[model samples]
Target: MARIGYARCSSEDQSLDVQIARLTEEECQPIRSEKMSGASRDGRTELAAILDFIREGDELVCLRADRLGRDTRDVLNIVHELDQRGAYLTVLDPHITTRGEAGRIVLTTLAMVAEMERRFIKERQKEGIAQAKAKGIYKGGTRRVDREKVLAMHRTGKGPAAIAKALGCSRMQVYRILDACEGAQTAA
Candidate 1:
């Protein structure tokens, strides 16, 4: 049976080195990794590929249950899928494997805890933001797109797609800027 590994992180800024090292230490081969949020199963192409190609008797390994997913439903679904394929899931931290009924119960409990922890984190963040706003320190998130640059490009007869390409941003962002500018001019 093949022992495959999967590593994931929430954002590009986060490192996957530790997780990868742990998986390697466990003698896992062909480890797949991605820098994406585990809050949801969406946009996790590497994980999807693993599920798609995993064969019977193969085992999917991760550093922790949370590395597999933070959502309980998603994690349970993944485990179910693995079971259906005659494959197994091995989480390193708690050292749990889906090779037994007891392991599945513990995994389910851990998945629930992970989901709850995610909710707690979000709640804490919201409270922190509220406190910052109360102290007049919250100026909202920094803008990644340049409104002036978008307007300048549009004035030069550039289409939304062309402007987005030039600014290295999405066409929807370009459209939003253009729409806001148009609305402001109309009001004036």
Candidate 2:
């Protein structure tokens, strides 16, 4: 009868440390399953570890519903799965626990909205790319510091570190520009 908690984060800078701390305060053992993205596949190792330890009537805690899963189908599926396993989910910030009807409905609605928004963004991007291609225009522009600027600084006898400083980047960028400069001469 272990009350296990699962903590997830979208990126490195967004920490699950605080969520873990809260879970610890609640006397629950926290499993941290983090990723660089939310768009990946269905499962996470930390979540699996939490599931492995949960028993009937055991509670699963998270900071927010969004931290658990991203879309309607995914969230509902996960919630349903946990319920079938006799485990309850509690999201701290919104104070929603799937043990009640209102919480389930709220979670479902939020998931649906997020999924719909994601679909709309994908559709819009596709349309934009299609329009640009139809007009014989490139779909993307040069990098923030593309070839011309890199070459211009290098031709001025700027060293890698100095060039990186001038361009507000790093020494690696300077080396890349130098390599590109060498390749440019070969191409000519």
Best by the lDDT measure? 1
Please, what is the whole-model Cα lDDT of each candidate in the order they appear?
0.91, 0.72
Candidate 1 versus truth, CA RMSD in Å, comes to 5.6
Give all TM-scores, in the order shown.
0.77, 0.58
Please, what are the lDDT tens digits per residue for candidate 2 over residues 35-83?
Answer: 4244433435556666666778888887777677767777887788789
Q: What is the lDDT of candidate 2?
A: 0.72
In model 1, which residue pairs have backbone atoms overlapping below 3 Å? none
RMSD of each: 5.6, 10.3
What pairs collide in candidate 2? none
